[model samples]
Target: MTRPLTVALVAGGALLARRALRRRIGASPLWPMPALEEPVSGRRRENRRPSSHRVLVAERTEPAEGVVRLRLEGADLPPWEPGAHIDVVLPSGAVRQYSLCGDPDDRGAYTIATRVLEGGRGGSRELRERLHEGTEMEIRGPRNRFPLVAAPSYLFVAGGIGITPLLPMVRAAERAGADWRLMYCGRSRASMPFLDELEQAGADGGRVTVVAEDESGPPGLAFLGGLPAETAVYCCGPEGLMDAVSGALGEARAPHLERFTASAAVPGGAFALELRRSGRVLTVPADRSVLSVVRDELPNVSYSCTQGFCGTCRQRVLEGEIDHRDELLTDAEREDSMLICVSRCRGGRLVLDL
Candidate 1:
């Protein structure tokens, strides 16, 4: 098993708010977006898939305490949907993913935000220190595994920095004239990003519930039971909140949500692992993860968020039927690559590209 992460804040969830509203969704009636694995921009995934592009840190701002918003600018950038995210490759070789929170119509740049977790992983700290206005770095993808779909109505719930992804969705829902509401919760009002914007946007039309644990206890999620199942619920927040909502609504009526952390399942028996590059054979015991065992021999292997939410630990599969356990990878990515931090062999031995 991976070691326990000392995440200080109560924000313990992955960015997993993927609710395909089961119909065509568009910001305006002019552009009718179809509900599919990709956006309705007519850009094919493989044909337009870019390598890495150098982007300048054009702008940076602290929207809230411990949260940084960066505007990475480049020329003729690819278009993205509301829930898309990009992989930021750092100078230190550490890779981190951030949801694109900016306007999708603005194709010249991408905007992303992150919250620094004290005593947690090091990516956010490195990003804050190394990145500055005019600094150039390589970034890949505006990949969308969580694109917004057409729904009769939407209920957006955000926790702390989790609002990054939902911000665009809220805007789209509002602009599209679809029925929607927001429930934004955080440690305090000062800790929540995009608070004023969300409040202003939701002020005249719909409900925008702001629950601060400092003043009010945990907000009651029991109202989910009364809502129509057709109401597409998009939730991105703490793990406990997601669990509470899911438990109350049940799996059949599951709320669409996102996670910032990995959820490890029951480990199977021991298995053999083959590293084709380094020519090393290792045994991954039942209680351990493949990442822990491989790191012993190959100390320089890149890894962050050992929970498997980040794509840093992904490796090519030379051979083996992998028991995939990560939410970071899409169906196409899972065809050959697997996140070593959580995935394991189905049975017997597995071969990797090291």
Candidate 2:
């Protein structure tokens, strides 16, 4: 009886030791467990993916007659690349994205230029009319979709307010001693923001052309025709100009365009969107945005920029087709999913991954 009891005790001790060893091995870095073993509680997990920062208005300057350059002061500003934009959450909770035109090397602050649109939405209007220096506002991201790609040479074209994103890229190119040229166009010099800086940067006899419509008439299609085959053309501007450029370029010489407005005028239609996880289907009116519909139906959903510039309200498409109107998603992403903020269903019915 004593031998049997001793044998059982030894077997039990070995089993416990083995379990401890297994636990230690699992906890080891070599095993590598996920940071969160379980799903984070609530929609906070989704909300946390897109980070937000607060910035104080440091200064405001009128670089041009209609353009207002805003300098924001914040130590916690996220590291951003050239061509990055931040979503500014205004006093009325309206979110709008502005390109970071400031020098990327300048860690002190981020700067953006806004052209007040008389008939446009309230975001830019509020900044122009109501907001001022020392005003505190919430800003999310230095998110960049229009990143500078490595090329042998570059051809940059800007129209009016579109120069904002390209400014940093131009500076970076200058710093790197890369081969590049810029064609900046506006109504006139007075309406062109950062004209002095642009002129000074090109003073070393760098290839930079200024085309004021009032002075030089509309920039001819020939301006783009002069680009070398080895050059990558990066353009940002109004729809008509972009469309003209797009029409002129062949497959071999297509200019990479960054559109300021995410949405174009699509035919108005009513649609039903099915949220898979939420198990809700909401009707989206022709006039209302998908973000409004989603937020109304599912109160827990989080969104920052409803204009589709920020990837905050991005959702996967499970079924049906989408008319993508967002700038954040790449061609592949747009093909795969939809930005619920601005994009809508095409076929009257759509399914989404909540």
Q: C-alpha displacement of 31 in model 1, angstroms?
A: 9.7
Candidate 1 accuracy as lDDT? 0.78
Evaluated with TM-score, which candidate comes out highest?
1
lDDT of 1 at 51: 52
**Local accuracy of candidate 1 as per-residue lDDT tens digits, 1-354:** 111211121111111111222233424422346546655385323322325788999999999999989999998788887888888888887777789999988889999999987776688898888899999998988777676765566788788888998999998877765567788889898999999998889887446888888878677776777666557778888898878768877767877777777664866889999999899999999988899899999988778667766677888887889898886787777877888889999989999887
The clash number for model 2 is 0
Show model 1 residue runs off by greater than 4 Å.
Answer: 1-50, 274-282, 292-305
Look at candidate 2 and tell me the lDDT of residue 183: 78
lDDT of model 1 at position 124: 87
